[model samples]
Target: MKISRVTARGFMSFDRIDLELNEGVTVVTGPNAAGKSNLGRIIDVARLTVASHAGSQRGNRLDVYERAPRHGTRRFRLAVGIELDQPWEQELIATFVRAAYASSAVELPRPAHSPNVSAERRDMDARRRLAPESVAVLLRGFLVIHYDEGARPRWRASWHHSSTGDLYEAVEPVWIMNLRNGGPLMRVKQEPSAPALSLADAWRRVFPDDQIDARTPMPEQLDFMGILKRLEHPISLRTGAHQDNLPLLDSVRDLYMLLGWDMEDARRGQVDFVHVLDVVLQRACVLTDNRRLPLARTFPLEAVGGEADLEDGSQIPCELYRLKNGPLPLRQRYQRIQARFTELVGTGFDVQATPDPERPGNLLIDVTVPEGDHEYPIAFSGAGRQEALFLSTLLGGDPGRVIVLDEPGVHIEPTLQRRLIQAPDSTTQCLVITHSADLVPVTAPGDLARIVRLAPSHDGSQAHRIGHLDPKDQTRWLQTLGPRDVRALLFSAGAVLCEGSTEVSALGTWWEGSSNPPSGANISLIDVGGDKSFGRYIEFLKAFSIPWVAIADGPALRPASDLHQQMKKQGILTATEPDSAEPDFDAWKAFWAAHNVFSLANVFGNDGTAAGEFEAYLKRLNLELLSQVDKGRSKPRIGAAFASQHPMPKEIADLYALIRDRLQPARLQDAQGEQA
Candidate 1:
């Protein structure tokens, strides 16, 4: 399932906001505290809540609402829209209320006494809002994986609270839900059905937890459990083995949830159920971040399942060494990771995962850069390369998972980011939160990928869907401009787009000489090629909400082109007075007085050739009997020289006036307030 929209009410720093998502990948961008990262966290929390509901519930009461913003309204609501291939859509709404259990008996009225009481006392106006079960039904059929800041995966053992207290049971409730029937549990071909045996009997025969409560939901038995239940002979259990291995067994289940059934099905057809459980139980992995794989000791490469001693003589997790039918051994998995990392990063650096000497059970990923004769650690390389390796490692292995990338570092090049996120109709769904414009692309409308911009609102922050670039315009932009150059426009406060390099230099020089300059004014003076390219640039800037205006040659000189008429139709240009007999630059000035944009073409003489370009018009405006202008002169060079030596021309001066008077103040205010 793909996320279509996220509606949040009173969710951290947000009073109410709706973020509509596209299919394959949706990039979230905004200034700091505008709540960009918070959006990702909200989704994670929503999914986690649903996952929480699939298993045991101690009571009807749940206290997850503790994290709600302290000062906002006492309630919050989150609604997510999911779309399935059947052309069906599901809306999941989760609500939370502050101190929901703190009220008197009246607040906790029984469902029979007042079935509507739950709705009446709900106070729909509350800022926080929902029960855990309200979100569970929608989370099925899709897996959501959240990568913390720096794009690091959160280890299975670490998803509980932040403390490091061997708290594997904290995840047991969620894990049990993952194995329940009709829960869209992974690693199996189909959802399990309700078991013929009771929960107590199933636990007694299969996995017996000393603490399991038989009354909770167990929609169906897992495949393994079903197999064990039907066995002709009872499998021998090591004395106290169930209690001693519960934690490790839970960890193995975590990996199975993520890796799915590819490895399991291979072993399923060949082995006895007892041997299968033994191999599955042995599956233990030491998870770490992409940047820092634990380096403890060195071990010899072995693929046939005998444990190799590390330099410190500690045993690696048996899972790493164990090989099952049709599954690659840990050594091969390591080599594959190294090769994929190299391919995605496009670097020849050698990556080896050797056992670290001092760390015993942990392995160290040694990155070596090739030098003339010797090699150096990969850390010696730049940050961008290192970040790329991390991202490549994180994204390469999984194909059908939901990946949430939190600030994967803006240093990853735009092209790579595009490739990583733009896989065509792939089952994987990627959501990225970035402050960099380089990661944002000009896409087709309703394309599989999109860019969403969040702006600050009075209640909190509001999110708006950013539309896409027309395909033809996007192609022209990419072909004519480098990714970096095009992306830079998004960061600029405002821009003055001109026909050629000459106009850029001329306007830049004039701005420098005036009370405000381009550098200090936080504006970009861009050479958009020519008159033909002006509309594309304008549309590009408008799509990103970047303030911009264009200056080009006269509209009258190019009669066949109705760019002016198009601009008027688009409401960008206003009507000017009827033509007068004589050339009066001031008379036409009234037409653009209220507009942020103006053109010198409106003021120049009707003489055809001279009004075709800015330089000709400048020369005509300063017509003198002994003028020494050269016809083949470098336009930008002459324009800059003229700007430095003489008073600003009337048209250029008036244009700057409109920019300062109409545009700069608002842009300046926004620039001053922009953060992150």
Candidate 2:
């Protein structure tokens, strides 16, 4: 099943956070410490062993009332909330303070007759806030796990701490295991196993030492227990000698099969195609391009044609031909497939074309296999081709797997990576973790997930959660971050976020001009015309956590001014106008008067009354005149004063001319150069 939402409170770097997940595929990413992996672990906690997962009592007793960590005050808490399709669940954490426990400074009244007393105290306004015991009690119900190798873990309770001692857990209590990046899966090497009771059990059965506690939550059977009981083996669908394999396929096939496709009820559409000598045969699905598809199969070559003898489970070589009454186009068509990619390899799949000679002249054609190398028992292929074949198999055999590729293109090459990213959706929900610029398409932004930047924290020691940024700002932030950081904060959306083109370009140029530019792909600039669009973009930014800012000018700006009330009304952007900014027309006049301009007419002109204006008067004049004057003309409008009352420079007019004609995201010759 899909994880729809996640939330964390009082945990490590995450003081409070909530992330949303969509149907099909939801990509989780952020900086190395923006807490993306922490978020992933939070979800993994939900998937731990039922009886094994436990909430820490230490997490409950953190000192309340302290805004930040202090000398004596501690804030220990672990609160998690998970949302399901229908029946959702939440966990509230609380700490406990013993009746006998007392601090010298602040005293609470106790029963006169009884020397000892116990009361459930929730202090919302205490110095540090909740009592150490108060938070502990709240943590009693949720299942949380943190993976530290030294801790002796148990199925019911993983902690050993005393209320009387000072070793209290922090506000964040998550199971943290430092796996070496991705671990040595390719090499046949394994680590030494731990020997505690549960560790022994985990080691004997090859399970993780840590797990989540189940009995603490809803009386339902624990999600992890069932998973451990069922998911006892690797996820493989090939014929196996064991009995448990049946359920593995059952779980994957049942929960994450392509949204609308059913593998069991296979249906193949028929096609009647004729090749046009003037036209080229192409495979265009709306996933990559938005063109209407033929009602039935457009070409026989495109369909997953009838079976073939897959020799020893290998990818059968069959070159697809365009029947345009000609030979092959460039072989680059096959380049669309990842070089190392081999679908249905070892899955008993194969492909080939059967030439026809009996039928009339052009009436006869060659066959193509859509389910390439997927027909079982007739082939033999090696694991070397497994990566590519796995993709083809997922696309064909299963309609499509919710391809949760954590950098599917990482181990692959550049061209293959591009092709893999561009692969037709084929009902596949692709949740890809990538930071490749090559994967980005010039015309289509569909493949791009929303951009999230992970930047440094105020405190140099531990990084803080900086916020989302606009495409322009994101580029700067990412380079400061690098590969590991950017990989974690990736996400996708359905709308276009055209932040201002000028601002985006300015930011890009400013960054490039630096001794060092930021890492990761260049930022994507969506062209939303003015601050009104910027306002909407900002709203999207806040809602989704992408960082962005819109810059609009004034004088012509009115209530229609983007920097004004509109954004504040939408609650999208904060109106942080400099105190120096005037509310109306007079502010600019005063500022311009301070300058050497002869008069208000020098800048404002007759259109000086233009409110809600975004362009400068002089720049606008140059642009208007340039539009009227052809490129070949000797002189431009120059504001109707060419060589007259204080004639203007031809450079300014020429620049405006280019601005009006060119479509570059941004163009500047450094006040001395020209557009290429």
* Whole-model lDDT per candidate: 0.45, 0.29
Cα TM-score per model:
0.55, 0.35
Minimum summed lDDT over a 10-residue window in model 1 is located at 96-105
Give a tens-digit lDDT track for model 2, residues 1-676: 1233444444444545554433344334432334333443343233332211212232232222123221122332322221111111011111011111111101234434533221111111111222333222112222332332233431111221122212222333222121111111011121324221221121223222122122233322212222223332321111111123222222122211321224443122100001100000011000110111111112233322422212122222322222122224323333333232332222232333343344322222222223454443221222324344434433332222233344344434556655655563544444443444433332222222323222222211121233545676555444423332222223311112223343333333333333433222222334455545545444443444443322234421333344345455765333333334434444443332222111112222224564323223334445554344334533223323222332334443442233223312111111212110
Model 1 agreement with the true structure over 1-676: per-residue lDDT tens digits: 4555666666666777766665566777654446676676565455444433322231122244334542434555565444322211111111111111111112233434323332123222111222332223222222222212222222111111111121222221221123212222122222345333322233234433222333435322323333232433322111111223223222223223332335444223211112211222112111121123332234433422453322111222222233112255444554554565566566555544656677566545455667778887656776666565555444443343345666765556766666555532365566777756556655544431376666543456666553455777456656543445555565455678787877787778888887777676667788877666666667666655566766766643232244445455556765554354643555544443444445665444346555556766666656541144334667677667666666776667777877765555434444444222
Q: Give the Cα RMSD of candidate 1.
A: 15.2
Give me the displacement of residue 148 in model 2, in angstroms: 6.9
lDDT of candidate 1 at residue 47, scale 0 to 100: 48
Off-target runs (Cα >4 Å) in candidate 2 are: 1-23, 29-33, 37-151, 154-404, 409-511, 516-527, 562-565, 572-676
The alpha-carbon deviation from the true structure for residue 545 of candidate 1, after best TM-score superposition, in angstroms, is: 2.8
